[model samples]
Target chain A: MRIICCVKHVPDTNAQIQLAANKKDIAREAISYVMSPYDEFAVEEALRIREKNPGTTVAVITLGPERVDQVLRTGLAMGADEAIHILDPDSSITDPLIVARCLAQVIKSGGYDIVFCGRQAVDNDAFQVGSAIATMLNVAGMTLAGKVEVDANAKKVKVERIVEGGTRQIISGSFPVLITAQKGLNEPRFASLPGIMKAKSKPVTKKNAAELGVDLNTKMIIELLEVPVYQRKKRVIQAGEDGKSAVKQLIELLRTEAKVLE
Target chain B: MNILIVAEVSQGKVKRASLEVLTRAREISAGGEIAVALAGAYSADAEKTLARFGAGKVFYTDHDQVSRQNPEAVFELAKMCAAECKAGLILLGASFLGKEVAARLSAQLGAPLANDCIEIKTAGNGVVVQRPMYAGKVIATVQLGGAQNIVSIRPNSCVAKESPAEAQAKKISLDSVSLKTSVESLEIAPLKRPELTEADIVVSGGRGMKGPENYNVIEALADKLGAAVGASRAAVDAGWRPHSDQVGQTGKVVSPKLYIACGISGAVQHFAGMGSSKCIVAINKDAEAPVFKKCDYGIVGDLFQIVPLLTQELSNSRD
Candidate 1:
């Protein structure tokens, strides 16, 4: 069995995000990058599948600049057999379709049985790449998957995905499918010292977007970026000079001002 | 230019989010024809409801295979509708279904897409949109470059209004596209409470709630206010609540009218999910909790006392 996990190096969720002088993209400097949180779940799930299927090989792929090699090494430490990094300086400006196309090229050439990716990149917040790749490849795809059950012998997989209104949809699809990881899917394993040391010598292949036949042109242009403005008048209630009376004032306010109550 | 709005129907009624997308489409039509596509099992009542919302033409498809929340089926139908109507702009609500359909359609048609857009407008024979990134910390204004544009409007940002225009209804049945994926079953939790995303008011608890059994206090508050129940990641991780009740970066993003946080310390991840709420009220025992700074109202008190008191007050005032 062969599995491919697509990962991304994004600014840590806790990192402070700043915009470039042009306001078209984020200022990359001074920000720490890590494997996107959901991607950790994807890599962990891939490793678990490899463990279950003795002969399975899991390869992790990333599309980014040279700095992203660090994340690939992290994936290697997490037990992926190899890493493929598609080096594209213009990666930040490209749209999700371009990224999906680049990944489709590699996945098709590798002839992998299944593919995994995080539900969305925390940076762009565009939950499109995995499904776009599936559409481009004409394969089955499931996003926001919370649970996965693979039947390698039957060439099918069952997935329970999170839907709107807190509903779960159990979906089944054939092999050569794509699944996007969601939270609570699985607990990711931590890399041990020995594993980290071993990952230093693992093979990390690099390719350019042009080499993969992916067009560098994008279908959208970012015109401007700005910090979100809050219009609410954050009026903190003065608790009527005491805690007990404050509750009374709050209820009266809710009834008269907010009108949420009564 | 022709514009097509993909309407989502649930339980034989058009979803408010989808209607909001139609409203947005009407506002940006700029003398162009506005059409709406309704897939899945829809009633004539739904079509009439959509028509009243200014749908010039209603394209619909109803079949067992297409009615099971199948993205491929809906994508095919949307693509066909776009092509048939010669639409230059395709709009849908950025709900689960809308995101799936727009993503697939954008890839198959090679169109530019902007997902979860808070604002979209006609820009000189093209379209420009604004969407939040970095978990609602920043907003990006983007210009779609392709001849065809697909956009998913964020829920609760756009309001649906009645225009009461007559619509010409059209039913389309296309050749079946091979579907490699099928929904086997849907296990929906039977909660009489309002859905978190759709609710006007949300009452959320956090680690301070202490235990799973203590959630009853939060539930009581929510029940009194007719609000949905939510929990922070800390509470969910502690197994005090189900994953579905979680509201954070990894959980559901909600923009309710009123958000009352109980015992939550106000982590950035939790704020990212509910930052867009219209009104925020934070109640915590810690006076210096981060939530106090961001909320519209703050009460530094024990949730155990405050919650029940608030619930009792609300219930008493209802009479």
Candidate 2:
């Protein structure tokens, strides 16, 4: 089995984001980057499938500036056999259409049986690239999978899709399937010291946009970047060393001030 | 510009998110026609609701293929409807089905897509949209290029207002079928309160709640207040609640009208999820919990004592 997991390098989830001087993009200098937390689940699942079924090869792919190569290495250290870096050094491309095209182009020629992507990237939060790639490749996509049972011999897969509204929809399908991993899919493992040492020796294949002949004109561009304006009243009622009085003040405020409670 | 709104239907009525998109559609339509490709179980009442919500034209389908939200079917429907109206822009409610269909359409149409957008407007010949980044810390204003754009608006971000357009409703006819996947079954757990993302009021618990069995206090308050039950990542990771009930950066981002955080210390990631809420009330024993600083109201007392008292007092006050 040949499994490919697409991962993204994004700013650390805890990083404090501020707009750049132009106010059209995030200030990147001081921020540290890491593999998006959701993508870690995909990479781990890919490795687990490889472990259970011998002769399976797992490859990790990412599209971004050269800095994104680190995430591919992270995936490699976590147990992927190879890495494919679509080097967008300038990070000029922000369009999902272009990114999907570049990714689908590579995955289509690889003859991979399965592909995995995080439910969404923490940075843009578009969560569209994987499905778009599936559409471009014309394959069955089981998105937002919380649990996946793969029948390698039968070429079938059963997925528990996490649909909102507190429902889990069961989707049963065959191979050549695309799966997007959510948080609860599995616990992503940390790369060990020996694994990190071995990852440095693994092959990292670099590909670029021009080589793929994708249309360079980005379809989506950031117009402005700003902090969200908040109007929170930020009031903390005096508890007066007890519970009853504070409860009274809160209920009063909800009625007269917030108007949320009748 | 000619715009198409792909509306999702649940339990017969058009979903609130769909109607909310219609309200946004009326604004960006710019005198051009605004239409809706109302998918799933189609009804005249839904059609009328669409009309009153400013749908100038309504194209509907009741094909069993869309009975359980087959993404391919929904995508094909949206594609044909977009072609039918020559839509310059398309909008969806950013629901699960909506995002799925929109992504496929983006690939099929070779157009840019902005998903889960909060604010949308028209600038020049194209559209500009604002969406959250890093959960909600930074807002990115995006411009969708080309003559066509596909955008999905976040739920509860826009108000659904009545515009009362003359309806030109039609039965949708597809040129071909591309259904492949089948749903074995869709099990909806019996829910007593609303889901985290869609709820109007949410009462959430954190590590301070202590254990799974102790969540009853959280649930009790939630039941009395008519709100959804939510949990912080700490509680979820500690196995105190289901992942579906988590509200934070890793969990569902919520914008309920009122979010009551009980026993939660207000981690940054947790606050980022519910920070956009209209009103926030935190109840934690720790006075210096970060949640208190960000909330509209705070009560520094043990949730075990505070929550139950608040529930009874609220009911009595209302009576």
What is the TM-score of chain A, computed separately for every candidate? 0.92, 0.97
| Least accurate 10 contiguous residues by lDDT in model 1 chain B | B62-71
Model 1 has an lDDT value of 0.85
Query: Model 1, stretches more than 4 Å misplaced?
Result: A90-92, A231-243, A255-262
lDDT of 1 at A107: 84
Q: Write the per-residue lDDT of candidate 2 for residues B107-142, one digit (tens) a residue.
A: 999888899899999888788999887898888889
What interface RMSD, in Å and to 1 decimal, does model 1 have?
2.1
- Tell me the deviation in Å of residue B319 in model 2: 1.8
lDDT of 1 by residue, A1-262 (tens): 8999999998887676778999988898899888888899999998998888899999999988788898899999989999999988756636888888898888888888889999888878888998899998888998888899999999899999877766678888998999999888999988888889999999988888778766767879889999766665455554443466667777776667877656
Quick one: RMSD of model 2? Answer: 1.7
C-alpha root-mean-square deviation, each candidate: 1.9, 1.7
Pairs that collide, model 2: none
Q: Write the per-residue lDDT of candidate 1 for residues B74-186, one digit (tens) a residue.
A: 88889889999999999989987898899999998889999999999889878999998877877899999788999999888877899988899898885566678888876
TM-score of each: 0.96, 0.96
